[model samples]
Target: MEDRKDSELKTFCSRNILIILGFSSIMAVIALIAVGLTQNKPLPENVKYGIVLDAGSSHTSLYIYKWPAEKENDTGVVHQIEECKVKGPGISQYAQKLNDIGTYLTECMERARQVIPESKHEETPVYLGATAGMRLLSIENEQLADRVLTMVTESLSRYHFDFQGARIISGQEEGAYGWITINYLLGKFTQKLTWLYLKPNGGDVQETYGALDLGGASTQITFVPQDKHIESPNNALHFRLYGKDYSVYTHSFLCYGKDQALRQKLAKDIQAFSAYYYVMNFLNFTSEEPPSQEKMIDTMEKFCSRPWEQMKIYFGDVKEKYLREYCFSGAYILSLLLSGYHFTADSWKNIHFMGKIQGSNVGWTLGYMLNLTNMIPAEEPLSKPLSHSTYVFLMVLFSLILVTAVIIGLFIFHKPSYFWKDMV
Candidate 1:
């Protein structure tokens, strides 16, 4: 009777164990199928586009960016789809002939119309942001700058695209946007850039990086300084990205740009060189007082007309003494970074000059588009839905765990009946 009872108890436990194992296996298989189905589903055909015309000091470039409609709110989703270079100096150079500025953008704007899908033209926002060149032009001759802007705006308005605006962006905006562009390209803003837009009151951010940009007419330095106390009020910029707040220091030296600085230096050098010649002429004749200031000015003007104008006269026939002011330009850049920004020797090495980040050019244009279109979401999207490979890995991991747990439970509960069974 005792032997029979023991056998019955073993049979009951064995049956229950088999049922549990079968159920777990079925559930695992079902879960895997569900995951597979979800993973294989076709992605939606919902793409949105935008166009940005970067009117920098040296040149102009048109960038067309696209992102999935569903992912518009996510950060770093907007990517450069196509970039077209405008075949001339930046629009600011056309300040004198403002009408010509409108005509010059014809080819590039037409290219944009062709590149973006016909359907997207009406919805797609087109923005033109002029950099240092326009900024200087505005400061020097506000009327001319306004006329140039009007010309470009009128030209862009004719296009099918939603012409947003054409104007000279502030130096602070340029620096901040460039910083955002780099960090976005580098995948630093994984979740949300900051809670800036959503919260009207204020908030903080996740992480940020420094950005250093060098352009023909201006240089910008921007970074979230560790120390909160900023000496210069103009240099300090306050931003709230995603939900995080950041205090960044940014400075743009007007005449310190590579091209302008080089021009200024060349002008000074020519004046000095011409003085040497004048002194020789004076010594050869009689020791009279040097020529008047006006004459000296006239001599300097002969050498310092535009660099190109000077090049035509001096370096037209021979290319021997071209780019002589490079040394002065380099020195000016160093001084701007060191003495102007108060960058120490140790920290100077950390500064990075980025023309491009990843595949896209590191400029303010991308960030500008992202901001206007609300690409950087206030809330984090579901952590990039797990990849197919990740799903497979996780499924296998759980299956193994289930099997191991079942086996351990069975062994713990059901002891071997005989010595021979245990040995087997």
Candidate 2:
């Protein structure tokens, strides 16, 4: 009887150990499943930011861009987050009053600080690019232009963000960067990955749109033409984008911008008006008081002021008559596009105007950032993530298999002892 009781007690203890092992295994599996689910949850993105200030002839604009930190080397990853238009005229206009130019940027700098996160201020790069207006200013008055740039640079340096050098960009750079900006925003440089290691349908030939940017002081035309015989050596630009070589024809018509062209038209109109007024004895003018470009534009503005008000009421301020005083300006644009550049009317359909694309403004700033950041890699990246549903399914299937194996091993190890107990 004592031996039988001892065997019964031993069997009871083995049964309890088996129960505890089974409970612990179930709990372990549950804990693992919970941990796996938690680990799989998507984390917040590690984002980097940049700022570019477009100091155009007519106005100044600030653009804030952001991209994922890990995807900086990926094409089409950069995106515009916010854009702030600085009040008042372009910095070039402040040639005589250089001190005020710095003051003009105060509001914009404050706004940028508010828009970008505080932590990114140190790393974020701020660039100031003076466009055609400053280019012309530099040509006409080098010292004054230098003063303007220096003042703006000094002001920008006061801000918390990293200040890159401020300088006047050439017309060629403007055209090329504008092209890059449009193509990148259109996702022309990026390719989608496939499972079979084969390119997607229609992926062999990349379809890219030409960029036509019309600013206040200059206009740019850049396009990849099949005809390699470039009309002008200065207009040809070769670039390797996303491992694809592109031979493009680009041209920037200086002093052909709306504002400058308006000034040009006013100069001609004022010459005629001055002659007529002197002949009529309506106005007095001397050799010392020569009619300047500024005087000409002001005269034209006064002459068209009444007509502009009427034109505004009739056509919402975008009528041909509103620009009738500067009709020569419109004719100049047409002549430049058709005759000067030899852009065929048939090819006009491919030209996309640079104003805004998908809510973001299309400009050289976007391209400028991409180049500085080294975002466009030569070789294509092969890494791609699996689908969300597939990943979850695989994890759950793995967990279930692991649990089954553990339970089977426990059963096998205890089988000898249980069998021995029963036999005894």
Candidate 3:
């Protein structure tokens, strides 16, 4: 009787063990499917389309991005269907004289709509962002913005494209969003990049990045850090503005742009660089008995005639550096910023140069993504290549976790007398 009972007990245990293993296997497969769904290429698989409108102080314009059926995820970045940043009086500056601005926006939309191929037209979602020039408008001039908005909306209504909300974003927001747009476009080839998410946004670590965005109306300086690395709302580091201590460490300094700056006396012969510091340095000739601020203001009243001969006494030995850095036009400023910036001879090679740009779309988009994705790595000791160091650590940790999970799963299946085995 004892042997029979023992045999029966063993058989029962074996059967239960098989049942548990089967269930566990099914659950593992389900978990894998979920992970795959989440981790698979983040880019959309369906036919993709989008429209980006940059409503500026001088002009409102549109850009159309699309992709064919086979090349779904590759839309918007490589191919820009239509890009029209027309030249017009910023509605706010002109105030009551905004009717032409409204009509101009309509024309841009109409031109964009006509250009985007009809096939990809139906499903595109249009997103618009207005900057420096638009944000500074007085309440009285705000009606011109409304008129432009109305004109743009009316023209775009011809197609299935829906109107996205437009915003006159602060400099910090503008800087962040600029980064986001760059990352999204660059995310296509980012997998090939083995370094810091150049656009590491807000997490628990509070990313300490320097954002310098120069736009047509104003410029911004944004510095945000992430507290930690988590995908929850609480994982963000705070945003700080440099100009206003309690506020975001970002500023939208009014009338400091290349165009606006040149029209003032402080502008002097400062037509070379697009940044305030550089421009200020160029215009402030030490030997010429630095002109009064009021005199500088008077100089700007003429709009566009530069007086350079007066600087002969002021430019000592540093004239070459100033000329080199400042000589580029708005379009050429990007390269200068990316070139070897001088920090110290040793560090200058890698110093992330803050080259002056004429716009903020790049910085603003990036800032937005960093905050939105919560990818900021921890604040490790600042090594020479700190970002690279953090990136390597993250990749190693992810690989180890993945490998361990796979090994443990195999062992559980291979061992029959494991923890989940049934007992009778």
Candidate 4:
């Protein structure tokens, strides 16, 4: 009689355990549904946190923006960006030493964490984008890129930080997004400068506008002439780089970036000089007559054993269009020429110094930063040039968490041992 009772008790305990497991599973499913539904819960009137990270071939950069007041009509955005740090061997190539690359990224993020105020960073949405050097590598190289990305992401995870978004996009996407940022700023400058430059009497300014952006491995020429008030997306800015089938308005060239010249061959012969020489050339201009081709060529041969400085000398007029010197480098100057316009050094209006790079002086005079989202039509939402956008990333995050929870619950319902296995 005692043995039978003990066996009955054991059976009762297992049955009770199964019943409890079944109930817990129902609760878990309901919980996941709650998390997913929260996505469409409608964001508050204003988002308090925002961040952006641009990891390029030569450097890594971060920008943080916050909406100060939460009113729908109260569009007040306060933001700060940490200084960019040098991180060579971008994503594409950095994969070789995956661990080292991750460290480079960590250093950048940690530095930002220090600079950003302690109060606001807890929930900042950090967006990171890696380009060129990382995008162009082979499959194995890309895997290395992924491995490093995962590491840096996990490292950032410790701080309750979320990747607002991160992706590896294409050159075209980059060009477009940059143009969007710049062109949005252009709105602030339009009527102000264009009005000022408007040839007094009549008969148009007899000229068009263009931009030259020289990055690590590529140079772009963007131009759009305004014959009559400039049309769609017009504040009259264009991007000539990374567009397909170009029999057209702008021009651009690849493998022509200043940094790239250091690795591969270049037409001009500054082979021996450091990258800063080019920087110095742009920044340090004096009343001193420009160097002679012969002298410049001699300098090159003596330096790179080629007629390097001479080319710069020969192209003196166009190269000089870059007024700020170092800010706009060689690639920018090259694109300046590709504008294929009759631009003397005089044509450079010093856009960087111009009150508003775009739009109305209202944005500039008011001393406010305009988000690309605000100034441009929110439609067609221009995005980073990659398959993974912020929406995509979040969708993935939600999907993963949901899938994982479901798997756990399913295992538990069918076999209680799964609970321990999942935990382990």
TM-score of each model, in listed order: 0.61, 0.70, 0.44, 0.46
lDDT of 1 by residue, 89-200 (tens): 7787787777677679889888888888898899888899998888988989998889888889898999888788987888888888888787777655544324222212
* Clash number by candidate, in order: 11, 0, 49, 16
How much is the lDDT of residue 95 in candidate 1?
77
Best by lDDT: 2
Better of 1 and 2 by lDDT: 2
C-alpha RMSD of each candidate structure in angstroms: 13.8, 11.4, 16.8, 21.4
Cα RMSD (Å) between model 1 and the true structure?
A: 13.8
Better by TM-score, candidate 3 or 2: 2
**Sequence-dependent TM-score of model 3:** 0.44
* Candidate 1, residue 142: how far the Cα is off, in Å: 1.4
Relative to the true structure, candidate 2 reaches a TM of 0.70
What are the per-residue Cα lDDT tens digits for candidate 3 across 1-424? Answer: 9988866876576566556655665655665555445444355433445566665544455665543333212222223445565555443444555445445566666776687656656655565666666666633366666665555555556556655555565555665454334433333222322332343333233223344555555655443334333343332234322111112233455665554544422222331112533444444422224444344334433212334443333444556434433433222232323341122334323223222222322334333423322322222222332355555565565555555655655654576356335422
**How much lDDT does each candidate structure score?**
0.66, 0.66, 0.45, 0.45
> If the candidates were sorted by their TM-score against the true structure, best first, what order would they fall in?
2, 1, 4, 3
Evaluation by TM-score, superior candidate among 3 and 4? 4
Best by TM-score: 2
Q: Which ten residues in a row have the lowest lDDT in candidate 2?
A: 268-277
